[model samples]
Target: KEFTYLIFPLLCFFYDKNTRRKEKNKRHCFLSVPRWVSLSLSMCLSQTLNRSKMNHIPIPITCQNDTEMSSRDIDYTVNALEVERILNYHFKNKRLVEDALTHSSYTDSVSYERLEFLGDSALGLVLSIYLFLTYPNLDPGQLSLLRASNISTEKLARVAIRHGLYRFVRHNASTALDDKVREFAEAVSQEDDPLIHGGTVKAPKILADIVESLAAAIYVDVDFDLQRLWVIFRGLLEPIVTLEDLQQQPQPVTMLFELCQKNGKQVDIKHWKNGSKYIASVYVDGNFIASGSSEQKEIAKLNVAKLSLHKLSDSRPTKMEGLENTGELDGKSEIEGAKQKLHELCRKKKWPKPSYNIKDEGPSHEKKFECSVQIVTADSMLSMTGDEKSRVKDAENSAASLMIHLLQESDYL
Candidate 1:
């Protein structure tokens, strides 16, 4: 899990025509949008200021009920109300926010992976529009940088954090206890640390992802009613600036560091075989994140790691292809990474030594090969199965448990 703030109330800055915010704020407490965002938004307003139609205005919230939002919850709470207000303000579409917050870590009854994908693209488009229109004066390079800066994971996570979004996240307990959500705590309360001891990191990533996915949702929702979107974007951004200024710089993913939290996640050299091809897997907390069968594992690791990192949100859209397809970074794959850090526990116990072997065990031997993982006594693998996942833990029997975990794990490729 990665770890990583505060600002303007969206209400004051966004809706100049004033209809809902005033009506809304009295009934509920909405989260704040950071002042930094205003810089990009202001740039857009500068250009549209004179246009009677484009200048600051207000539009209807469209959604009167949040049933769709609540349905996404595994255990609903008042946070659904918070999501409702934010979604209403930004997308004027509540469904997107609900989907973005869905976590794959939740029980089978809940998970938001598909929604996360859609939201990811949606945020990208919104960021692009915010940059382009805001910076009528900037060249392409400057616009790119500015957009990248705002849309990066760090920034997006901050957006979610500032608004008290994490308190609403759904995941196993370990994650809820992590510092991953600290940055998202309100002005008063602080969240815990950002490392997933077990399977909870999934929760934090989903929360961070919702920030951008929701942004994307707002963009798409706005398309049907541009004026309404503009007003909401205005409230969300008002504390930042005239839209024109936001376009002056570029936005980059590097601005965010929450993804860099203490999971022992890092890029390392690794190799695997897919038919005659060589592939690589990136590991975090001793678990495979994304893997590739490539001639160059280093580059493959980076590409897959980046893609997996980008896919943190449940709202994100992921493509499926067989494992053999992942070796090429440009191609898509249906592969899933390691189950959780149970593999980390095994590695900690040093139950199995790391060994790289290259033998073409034919497909016919798949079952026998899997069963023999422990017979070789070389290494153990751990994975998360939906039902029993929570039972695997760092415990009194951790050493033996580690061995057991490794015996069940799968190497990513």
Candidate 2:
């Protein structure tokens, strides 16, 4: 009799799932079952239902247009519309949006993993096309750097936090995801730069995943129009980094290497663990310049690099006189008379004079001169090599031009 009672509920559930859509009136027929049995079945369905079991036994899950939805369904739909308002792009299918926000922790329905995968690809393509069109002269390498900076885990996670997208994520109530997200939010609130990656608190990947999944939902809803996707979400991705922005935030490690190379000195950065924090020590020519420690190794490296720059700055030569200050530096002057301009900049900045190195190549009739220009900053010496030219003077000018451009990009100018 106990077995019969258990089996009866399963039969009733299967019947309810199969008949609920076909004949709405017949759905009530399962209500005729005993109260305790109905309660037990409802509890089981709510807790254990998944697609794999549904394929085997046909458990009734909610349909797209079911009039009688649970309170949870209504909440998800409302959240979807709110997100639509935030994104300024209405979804034809609210289900996709709901799915995007639904974390794997939520047991009732689909998660955003698949949508995130699609969105990741779509976002990359859209950003690539935008960069290519917007910056006609940028090399593929530079374009790639810009795209990466914009879509990085830190960048996208900041987007989610900045726009309150994190509020829409549906996760298990028992999980600690909310606490971690709150902690991250609090940490980033103090940051001045929205796109900065190296911070005291690392960005939780789930926040980034939410942005990607939402993007995928929009892409799918709009029939995969790459341009339309950009048009819709461009505002959300505000303050997109441009070439100038990219130049402003130079990689400290690369700059350090270039600086040491120009000075004919070797550079080395050593990493070690000091208790819970990571420590990075910057060395030039086997001498320790500065050290920085952080919770993350990369952040420590960057900190040390900045410190090293300051240290080198203090040891640089005093400013030389008699060079005219050409107001603010621009690209045209850097190319027109790069050699003289570099000398003027070195004088104005109170740094060491610029030095040029030349290499001759090819046969005498088709000879070429490759020039490398070097200059000392406050803490380090930096070098820039120009394209080979037929004459030594032209090569020297080219090298100086490249050096000026490097300084501009690195914000040294």
Candidate 3:
């Protein structure tokens, strides 16, 4: 009778447990559990079955989620479709792309931080491989520099802006971000040099994060295929900086130092901060030659260097003639009064007067404007648009400056 009672209770317990397992499987079919949890459970179940001497019978283990889409995921899917269109590549898992574009500020969802971390390493590795294979003649140092420049935060940020990838990012409304993005965009639009490290404004890291996170999203979507990642990114990062570009346009600071060294003059740069602005002064042989200011210390230094180069070159035109002729020296000073310069150039060439189109955007209190210049030709339309600025004139000048630089570089000035 005691043996019968024990068997009855054991049978009831097994029946209840099996019923619960089946119900659980029905409710959760997504199987989103971590790998370690699945492994641990499998081991425990195996040991229990072995001890119980029921190894002949099979026990099923499953963990899953409901197939119905969550409201949040549905919203993400819409955005994901737009992003996929921009990337020209569809995603097998839309959630990955959604997570990539989401900033940490957006609560209750996965952020791009983890994906950015993965992408940082993956991007570096892929770029290193490309550099290694593409330029077999380049030494390690040269290759390292190329890799670093190509994968730099500034470069990636530029790529994000150039490709309009920033528009898809999901983040909380941030005034600081808006201002930074606006300033950087303006700087980029005004800049005509592709090989330059960055434009007048410092690039925001958020932009770079978006790019890296997107790269990781693609990498994961392609099953961690580095080759596939490269194929997608190669086109996104257009106008890749080449060895010739690097050699032709060295860093402004480096160029200035070399110029001074050749002339037996000591180059000294001093930096300080005034309010939100960082100021840099260029001193040659203990005499202050020129000064420049920016929101970034490095950019301020570079600005002063370029300004000093202009001053030095003008002071000894004959000595710097060779450098200027070879296009090593920046003709950046000509960009000043760029509107007038463009008008004069058009008048001189007997081309139609450059036409301007202005756009005003943002809140009234913090309004921004952008300008685009177009010069219609018989066979083509040459146009340039500047980054948004606080003033319409500044925006117009920025656009004109870019156009002027392009013309000068093409030997049409």
Query: Which candidate's lDDT is highest?
Result: 2
Listed per candidate, the RMSD to the true structure in angstroms reads: 20.2, 16.2, 12.5
Give the better candidate number (2 or 3) by lDDT. 2
Candidates sorted on TM-score, descending: 3, 2, 1
Clashing pairs in 3: 28-64, 29-64, 29-65, 30-64, 30-65, 31-64
Better of 1 and 3 by TM-score: 3
> What's model 3's lDDT at 50?
43
Q: TM-scores, in order shown?
A: 0.36, 0.54, 0.56
Top-TM-score candidate index: 3
For model 3 the local lDDT of residue 139 reads 96
lDDT of 3 at 361: 80
Deviation of model 1 at 335, angstroms: 56
> Per-residue lDDT tens digits of candidate 3, residues 271-364?
9999999999988999989999987686688778867765675466442244335764344542678998787787677665665656778998
